[model samples]
Target: MTVRTTDTPVRVMIVDDHEVVRRGIVTVIDASPALTVVGEASTVDEARRRLPAVRPDVLVVDLQLPDGTGIDVMTRARELSPEQRMLVLTSFDDDAALRESRAVGAAGMLLKSARSRDIVAAIEKIAEGQTVWPSRPAEDEEELSATDQRIVELIGDGCTNREIADELGIAEKTVKNRITAILHSLGLQRRTQVAAREAARRRAGWK
Candidate 1:
């Protein structure tokens, strides 16, 4: 549950390359009594330039930008303000993008197809320091063997491939091969994504 500590509406910033999409989100947010639109940007560069000045409570950003991806914007924002809250609102339902956004500390993710009310609700939750991420399918977790799960846990603990191999009594080459297979099975592109997802699951009390 999310609860606001002040009467001030949660200030929101919208970043999307499409003007119409930005406006639509802006409208939805402003219509909420608990949220307000404070600024807007169409590119990662613009977002970087305006973020500090706007000092928004939450940033609602699209994954694809004219200058760079939304991950770039979130990364920069995290550098500038470690406590900054963000939400990814994009047309694409990409697992890689979701993991990247989570790694960069986005508080929530919503597709553009989500209802306007749902978007506003997510912003409110994020503003209050609550997360609103979609749960990964159980079948995805079932795909990992016990060994693969152990590898993921080790990676999340900040172990390198060589370290993981030494810990598991396996050759480094075998560890690399297993990691490659893990990435393929989980629809991830990098070990960092696996680590991030595993860390998130731990935080969520998943075994």
Candidate 2:
């Protein structure tokens, strides 16, 4: 298990478009001894303006912002500070959004319906460099061949089919066929999902 090296509270920034929700989150964060709210924003524009200055240890963001999206904020945050940790706190349980968050390096995701304690714990875990995604059933887990695993890693590295093919010393058609098989094996429909899964695995320090 990962442990924090310091006793200081985890600094947090909230980006949600709802006033009531934001206030409630602020309350929950303030109630925690291990977490503190450094800033809050109700719009994407506001978040972008304040993010660099505040530089919170974790950013808890909602997906549907007035000006843009949580994805936009997370992407920009990554550009500004690659080490910035983020958590998605959204009402929408969207697979695409989740995959996008992982692709952009969010440490975790939580539904707005989650208990307050879960939210606090998620923030704490994210601050400690741990992932807190929703748990999948055992049946959803699947093992991949070594070649497929390498392809997943290449996809996570943003390699195109041709690039992966050349790097693996295989034909492009073979690469595509392998990716299709991988998608089916993983119960995923899109290449982005494969990439996102690989990214999350790496972030969690999985071999």
Candidate 3:
């Protein structure tokens, strides 16, 4: 939860690569009495350039873009205006992306799969400085989940995807999918890196 420091109409920016999608969001915001569309961007560079000038209270952004990502935009936006609340409005609902959003300090996240009304409501809530969505599970100590440890253990043991699958009694594809997810959770690029980090942790007496 948060509290707004300003009394102005909720100034909003929409950053989506799709023109139709941007226009549609603008239409919805324009209809709302408490909200106003201050600016719009279809690319990360454009959004980066325009975001500060507009000084929006809330930023509604898509995940993917031609030049960069909404996460990239928000990362820069946070540096410029840390007080501004950002709402992730994207088609992606995966845990990794959500975790990344939380890492970068987005106020909330909503999927494109959500209803138009629900999207608007999320925007309104964020604009009002209220957290509106469930955040990714992040603990103070970055407590790794049991599944994360299993993946790390297999990776550290130099187990291939098939090997991990056989050991865990799951399909190889499932192991591969979980590896991708584990990489995201750990903010790593490859499975080998997960293995390296997990080995270091074990060396430090972490089970």
Candidate 4:
């Protein structure tokens, strides 16, 4: 549900590489009765520069970027003001990215496909110090075997199946088989989800 209140306008900074997405998020924030888009950036460097100047109450960041990942932004924001509330806005549902964002101290994580009202609600919830995530628990990372973990870790680093095989000195078919096993064990549907789940678990400080 959309949180509407003109009395407590929450200032927000938008950080995403996509112009269309940044514009869309701005539109959503502007339409909200209690939220305002104070500033925006397309890269971590740009975000770092604008962050202090804007000093927004909440920062909405995207995971994938041209120059660097959103974690860089989170790291910088934490350094500048650890108290600042950070909410990630990303199209990726990768488990590793989610975990990394949380590890870096994001207040919440919202899918980019979320409804406008949900997005607005997330902003308010973060502003009020509430953590927001998907209802279901992300898959566990510790279920995988040592080999499976290595395969997934390589995948998380953006390595292709062939590259993973070459690095592990295994056949391509073997690499694919290991990846399949990893996915099955973790109850994940995608490689990105495996990475994202691992990231979230790490962020949560689980073993």
Q: Over 4 Å off in model 2, which ranges?
A: 1-4, 137-207
Native-vs-model 2 lDDT? 0.85
Regions more than 4 Å wrong, model 1: 1-4, 141-207
Question: How many residue pairs collide in each prediction?
Answer: 0, 0, 0, 9
Model 4: pairs clashing at backbone N, Cα or C within 3 Å? 94-196, 95-195, 95-196, 95-197, 96-195, 96-196, 96-197, 99-199, 99-200
- Please list all clashing residue pairs in model 2, or write none if there are none: none
TM-scores for candidates 1 onward, in order: 0.68, 0.67, 0.68, 0.67
Give the C-alpha lDDT of model 3.
0.79
lDDT accuracy of residue 169 in candidate 2: 96
Q: Which residue pairs show collisions in model 1? A: none
Error of 4 at 113 (Å): 0.8
User: Model 3 shows how many backbone clashes?
Assistant: 0
Positional deviation of residue 150's Cα in model 3 after best superposition, in angstroms: 12
Q: Given candidate 4, what's the lDDT at residue 146? A: 65
lDDT values, one for every candidate: 0.84, 0.85, 0.79, 0.80
1-207 per-residue lDDT for model 4 (tens digits): 223244778999999999998999999999988998999999989999998899888899997777777877877888898788899988877655555566577878889999999999999998877889765454555345567677777886779999999999866755764565566556677889977876776688876
